[model samples]
Target: MINGILFRQRTGLPWRDLPACSGSWKTVHDRHRRWSADGTWERILRAVQADADTEGRIDWSMVSVDSTTCRAHQHAAGASTRAPKIPGRRRSPARHRSDEALGRSRTRPDHVGGDKAYSSRRNRRHLRRRHIKHTLPEPRDQRANRQRRGSQGGRPTGFDKTIYRRRNEVERTINRFKNFRAVATRFDKRA
Candidate 1:
């Protein structure tokens, strides 16, 4: 059943088109719905991350954050209207306040990298508060605006060209996710 659900997710195939070898599509979907509603997937992911951290398997030297917008299919537009009324399905209290669908790290990494889109003053301030070194290049217009303010413009933001070059890795990772048709097209409408 898990295999069927994963296959469907990977291929973005409709439930009716699921292969018979993986068992009934309805059963697979039902299991997925149940697991999702119960937060089983979240628990599983947390456990895996915990185990990896305990085993010293995660790299903490650098981290990257970025966002990508996916276009939703027309069929995926209506699920938000049918909210599930399941009991005892609230989000965990331990979840980080900063969690926003982007992946999480167990520890603050030594350095962070992102694109110009994430180089806003608020974002930089947030990173500063966290003491996370960031390599986000200011957009030309923003730089010009700051310069227009003279001394009040403050010192230029620190940027490491060498580290910023690695931001391409984040872009490639997003592209890989978009390779999954369901993710790229947002087949699941519920947020």
Candidate 2:
């Protein structure tokens, strides 16, 4: 039964389409929903993660977190097939002017590679409060402003070019996640 659920998850197949070897599709789907509602799945994960942690198999030092936009699949769009998938691909009087519409087990990471978009002072302060060291590059404008302020500019943010280069690891991970049809389709309308 569990294998049936696993099969569906990996292939992104609808419940009814799950192979018969595992069990009746209805039973597999119902079991999945039941386990989900009862927190059984979360319990299983916690148990596995705990065992792995004790065995020194899991790394807790740093966790990369990032986000990206995924296009809605045609089936997900219902009858609204006329809407342009690409924003601003064509300009028409009737075309909408909108450009685009855009988990947390770990409390914190020992270190983080940050995007320039997250280089705001508030974000930095939050990380500092959590004692998280981040490798975030300052924008040119921010650098110029600090220089313009002279003595009142405070300390320059710590940036390591070597560390910033590793920021792509998170990006690549996100891209890999997009490879899953269930995710790429944004079927649930949420990430």
Candidate 3:
């Protein structure tokens, strides 16, 4: 069933097209839906990350955050609007407040690098609050606007050209995820 689900994700194939060897496609889909709704996948990711951290194989020195819009297929539209309730009593306060969208590592990274698209005042302030150093280049228009305002515009945000160069790594990582057809062109209708 896992294999069936992975195959569908990798190929962006219709659930009905899943091979018989992988068990019934309906069964695989059902399991996926249940696990996703219950945050099983998030738990698994956190567990794996914890193991890696314990083994001293995970890096916390730096991490990047960025978002990409995957063009949804026609079939990917019209998911139910109701939010799925996670199954279980409330956990620790920290765990409950953690952002799952950031993935397994909720710890603040020493440094973060992102593209201009992520260079918003709100995002910068969020990073500042977390004490995570960031390297994000200001957009041209924003730079110009700040300059036009003279000293009243406040000092230009710090930018490190050398550090910003590493942003390509984030871009490359995103590109790798996009290599999976289902992720590249969101075929799942469920949000």
Ten contiguous residues with the weakest lDDT in model 1: 88-97
**Cα deviation of 61, candidate 2, in Å:** 3.9
Best by TM-score: 1
For model 2 the TM-score comes to 0.68
RMSD from true fold, candidate 2: 10.0
Per-candidate clashes come to 0, 0, 0
Please give the distance, in angstroms, between residue 105's alpha carbon in candidate 1 and its true position after superposition. Answer: 10
Query: Hey, what RMSD does candidate 3 come out at?
Result: 7.0
Q: What do the candidate models score in CA lDDT, each in turn?
A: 0.73, 0.64, 0.73
Q: Which ten residues in a row have the lowest lDDT in candidate 3?
A: 88-97
Instruction: For residues 1-191, write the lDDT of model 2, one tens digit per residue.
Output: 98887777667777788777988998997888789779888778766655555565644555444556665555444434564354311221111011111022444567767677767788778888999888777899998999899999878887778767767777777666656666555342111
Q: Per-residue alpha-carbon lDDT of model 3 for 64-161, expressed as tens digits?
A: 66666667687766666684432222221111123344454555667888778778889888999988898888999989998999998767888888
Q: By the lDDT metric, which is better: model 2 or model 3? A: 3
**What value of lDDT does candidate 3 attain over all alpha carbons?**
0.73
Off by over 4 Å in 1: 78-106, 188-191
RMSD from true fold, candidate 1 = 6.2
Q: Candidates ranked by lDDT, best first?
A: 1, 3, 2
